[model samples]
Target chain A: MSVIILAVFAAVMILLLVGLTRALKSPSTGFARSFAVVAMVLLPSVWLLAMLVYADSEMKKVSFCTSCHEMKPYGESLHVDDDESLSASHYQNNRVDKTKACYVCHTEPGLLGYMDAKLRGLHDVRVHYFGKAPEELELVAPYDNAVCLKCHGEAKSFLEGGGHQYPDTLIDALKAGEMSCLDCHDLAHHLED
Target chain B: MVSPFQLFPTGPEATTRVLKRGVVAQILGILVLAGALFTKMPLLMVVIIPVGALLIALGILAWVWAVVWADAG
Candidate 1:
């Protein structure tokens, strides 16, 4: 898909070069003017929009998130051998798509959630470039239980777990955001010391 | 009643100048867009794409204005 978009962009740019050159040489010519409009204006508008969409999709991949030096440890954390590590467990066990592992856990589902994640991603890029990066990375906000419940809320192991069943209201508390899954399952990412 | 000439004074020099500006903008926009697309970096997403799009839009507007003026001439 990336290759295809790049190929189409190259073709459009070549056409634009030809049209713009002709239009510049003969600004009074009707055919050249029209060709310039189609090549320089219309084709590029469509292609730029396509590129934005492609960029958004690319940002959802783990590789995109982990491209920065600060994010390398988090990416490596996904491969930790420990089963207790939330990211590693989910990644190694195929709970989420490997290509989009970071996005799956970080982004809430739905349009607003997706937009919020993208905005945060932009902020991250800003901080990475212009501001100080912390020695240890932290979430901007507490990890929401809702993200976990989206998948685990109905899972057999989660529902049948002794800790959830013992208090009876534990599940409801979790659902209502009164309890955090991390309280018990705290080894979210065991980064190497 | 405003004549089209009053609204968009047409001369070969004016057409050439405006068209040159438009072409320059389009070329710059294309370069920026190409850089963003090829790099696929998050920084480029924030910085490059918007700048490229703006340049392209300005170019399109200039080209249209030049075309209209040229036709009137």
Candidate 2:
């Protein structure tokens, strides 16, 4: 079954290549242009299905998030966040597990969200290649604390005095500065240590 | 001589080429998933492999489809 699928896939690739050479001028209207038609319809669907499956199985693992060495600071900070270290309060206290609990905020929804992330990654890659990113690690800019608020919302008991305690009357404090969740807490998940 | 269809007297065009690649890629992606089920490899890596393949296919398809769709327009 697998072999047949692979062969059919290869055949389709060959057909598309041949089709491209033939239909350079007009593609859609052509009856032989079924390749374009099928591709157009199937790509997103496949991607969505794959993501759903992958996410269901492994995407939610905290270990996956802090795999990168750069994420160590983020990871360590999550453990260190407690009343003893209110000064270092980053991700809402012991309530949220730092290791496997970032996607709850960082991840957005839909195609544009995915594309935007990919583009950002491409930029990060380019920066790393060209030595433009930071010598050390840094926060994902525009890391609006708003995402933190998405879940925390100053509603959780543990967050009564949590670092991310959405400041009331900060109507000015928020606009006055570039404060974000990472400003205090270190990177949590996807650790490299 | 008459052909079954009046296919512009040549092989597929760029648009069709990309389309074919994408469909094949998606098909191969499915196969990868199946193979993963039968293999001992890490499910994470196995799953990820197909994602890359799928993206390549979709990216190419989008590129080509825009060309053909535009030309047709």
Candidate 3:
């Protein structure tokens, strides 16, 4: 009986081994296959989350608005300029978080907006790589009505500075075809001396 | 019982390898790139680690194909 039991135990272990191999084998496939499927499912989620967080800001907040690398220096200028300067309008406002990052204000909302921003970004990258951008990049923030409407479109009173000190003439002018917010609020934060 | 490992003769094999490893390697590469994006791993995509791995797998397949199906007849 002991001899038969030993044989049976060996047979069971062999059967388990064979079962695992058979399950793993897909003609030539292996256990490595499952890992790929899992990885593919995960990457886009992180990218999407990053986009959603940054999307809340206005479109002009894109780093390219004030300049590529120039914007950081401009943002740093705010701390030096202090709140007293007219340059400190929306940026250094007492209640608002002034240290918000570059993309927070520049990019748009949702996946399509991110794609749009990235497409524009490709152009900027090409320009930068080819040495087309000037040493001091232009402050061409496209403060269109759609951009301002992101924060103020719903409230008619907010557009008139009822509860908000933020500029709304931008939305009004954009609607009226007069001008845009970037015409004056041009720099990333504000320009230095 | 015949040894399963010896199912094929040890003589010269065919020289016409089909390059299926390229397909596997390509898929693994895309998954790795996706993983890098997911995990916030820096220099993963920039270094083209995914493509590099795929290339290595493809190279291995090419070598195997050469050994197995190398028109040496």
Candidate 4:
């Protein structure tokens, strides 16, 4: 898919060059004029917009995020078979879509959450390039409980689950930032001990 | 009345300069786009996308500007 996108971009570049050349050489009419006016100017703008949309969607895939060298461990953690491993359990048990696992779990709620995630992704890219890639990467902040509750909050299994049986205290603790689900459960990435 | 679309300016030298600038912009736009896509660097992408588009836009503008002032020759 990435290859296809690259090829399409390359083709557009070629077309732009060809059209520009034709306009420069020929008289201001006929094939040269029409191709220059339509193909050179308009087609590229449309093609670029399409490319941006395609790239954005492709970048959401788990494969895309894990492509970064520093992220491979986290990606590997998802495949861990141990039930205690939060991300592994979610992935192995089919709780999350494997293809979009990164985005599914990481993208926050509300209107700008996805955009915010994308911006953070860009920051990661910048860090990877400009800054020293961390020997051990950790989340800048702790994970939000709301992310977990976003799904499990309403589920009967979660509501009746052992630790969650006390809805008021547990839910309040989880929400008020007094407790983290990870305090008991294993961390999601399982990158380190 | 002058047609909106024209190609070669009466001063061929100036027309050549525009073409040269257009070509350079096109190359830069391609470089930015290809780098963003091949590397799949998200931060690089966020920066390059708008810049690449601007380069392409400039390339087109250079071509159009050249044509608008161009002679029928």
Candidate 5:
């Protein structure tokens, strides 16, 4: 499927090149002129649209996020069999989409969440390549409980789970920003001391 | 008996200029995409996607300018 999509793009590229060659002509008339217009403008526009769609789809993949050298360890942690690792347990238990586990925990709720993440990913790229990276990896901001609550806040199992204590009070604290889910669930990448 | 270049022979100087600009824009767009995806520098996509759209716009303008002006003489 991927190969076929690529082949289509390649064909389009070839057509675009042909269009460009035709466009170089000084004086075209009638049908030739019309073909030049379509080739030069319409075809390239379609190709660009397809490129954006392709990029968006690729961004959603776990492989895309973890391909970064700095992110490799964090990606590996997801596969750890230890029950103590929060992210690993989630992966092992199928609590999150394996393909989009990063997004599951990271994306805030709402339309802006995806856009925000994409922007953040851009920032990551800049920092990774052009900026002075930190000696140790850290979240750019403090972790937000809201990201967790987006999924588990209303889930029956989470609310009624034995592990939670006075769930309402904890949730209130979470909302008030007086508490952090990470305080108890601090195994994000499980970096060693 | 048709030569490739003659198939769509080079346009007037104005047409050539517009087409050349379009070609450059398209090349820049491709570079943006390569920098973004291949180097794991997705920040470049912020530039790439816009450049792609820009290429489309330029291509249209080039075509229109050619039709209205280049061929007028």
Candidate 6:
């Protein structure tokens, strides 16, 4: 997909260059004027839109998130040898798609959640470049149980687990958001402070 | 009696000026877009891409304006 976008961009750029040169050389020519309009206006608009789509897809990758220096520790933590680390366990065990591990866990479940995640990404970019990056990364809000339940809620292991069964209302509380999944399974990332 | 200039200014000079401005803007936009695409960095994605697109949009508008309001000849 990215390769295709790059190819299209290159083609448009070549066409644009040709059009501009011709138009500038002979502004009186009708063919040059028409070709210039198509090259400059139509081709570029389409290419820009395609680039946007490519960027959106690329941003979902784990590599993209870890590209920033501050995020390197978090990315490394995913590969930590500890089974107790939530991120590491999920990543190593293939619980989530490794390529999009960051996005899958961080983003909420619906369209609004997806948009919110993208907005937060923009904020992260702003802070990363314009503002001072904090020494420690933290979530803007408390981690929601809903994000966890989206996957584990229906699992038989989760439903019939002895620990959860011991306290019957525990599952209910977790479902109702009264209790957080992180309350017990808090080893989200084993970052070295 | 409505003058031709009053109805639609068909000056070749004005057309050339607008076309030049549009072409310059388009070139700048394409360069910026290419740079962003090459790097594929978050900063480029967040800041540069939109700015480049905006420049192109403005350029296109200018080109259209030149074509519609100014003399091609």
Tens digits of per-residue lDDT, candidate 6, A32-66, equal 78887787788878877776676677789999999
lDDT of 1 at A9: 80
lDDT at residue B63 of model 6 (Cα atoms): 77
TM-score of each: 0.80, 0.44, 0.46, 0.68, 0.72, 0.78
Q: What proportion of the real contacts between chains A and B does each prediction keep?
A: 0.46, 0.06, 0.00, 0.22, 0.41, 0.43
lDDT of 6: 0.82
Model 6 complex DockQ against the native: 0.47
lDDT of 2 by residue, A16-104 (tens): 45544444445545654564444434433454355445543443345544554444466565555354432224355544444445544
Worst 10 residues of 4 chain A by lDDT: A35-44
Task: Please write out the lDDT profile of model 4 over residues B1-73, one tens digit for every residue.
Answer: 7654433345556665676687678668766766666655566667778887888788778767655555433
Writing each residue's lDDT as its tens digit, candidate 3 over A87-130 gives 35545553234444344345565687667766665566566556
Where does candidate 1 chain A have its weakest 10-residue lDDT segment?
A50-59
lDDT measured at residue A73 in model 1 versus the true structure, 0 to 100:
89
Q: Write the per-residue lDDT of candidate 2 for residues B1-73, one digit (tens) a residue.
A: 8653344322335444555465455555544544433333233443455575565456555545555443443
Q: What is candidate 4's CA lDDT for residue A113?
A: 74
CA-lDDT, candidates in order: 0.83, 0.48, 0.42, 0.72, 0.69, 0.82
**Best to worst by lDDT, what's the order?**
1, 6, 4, 5, 2, 3
The fraction of reference A/B contacts recovered in model 3 reads 0.00
Question: Can you give the lDDT of residue B65 in candidate 1?
Answer: 80
Of the candidates shown, which would achieve the greatest TM-score relative to the real structure?
A: 1
Question: DockQ for all models, in order?
Answer: 0.52, 0.12, 0.06, 0.29, 0.29, 0.47
TM-score of 3: 0.46
Q: Candidate 4's interface RMSD, please?
A: 3.0
Q: Candidate 4, what DockQ?
A: 0.29
Off by over 4 Å in 6: A1-4, A21-37, A153-172, B1-16, B68-73
lDDT of 1 by residue, B1-73 (tens): 9877777657767777787788778778877876766785788777877898899888888877888755665
- Find the 10 residues in a row with the least total lDDT in model 5 chain A: A23-32
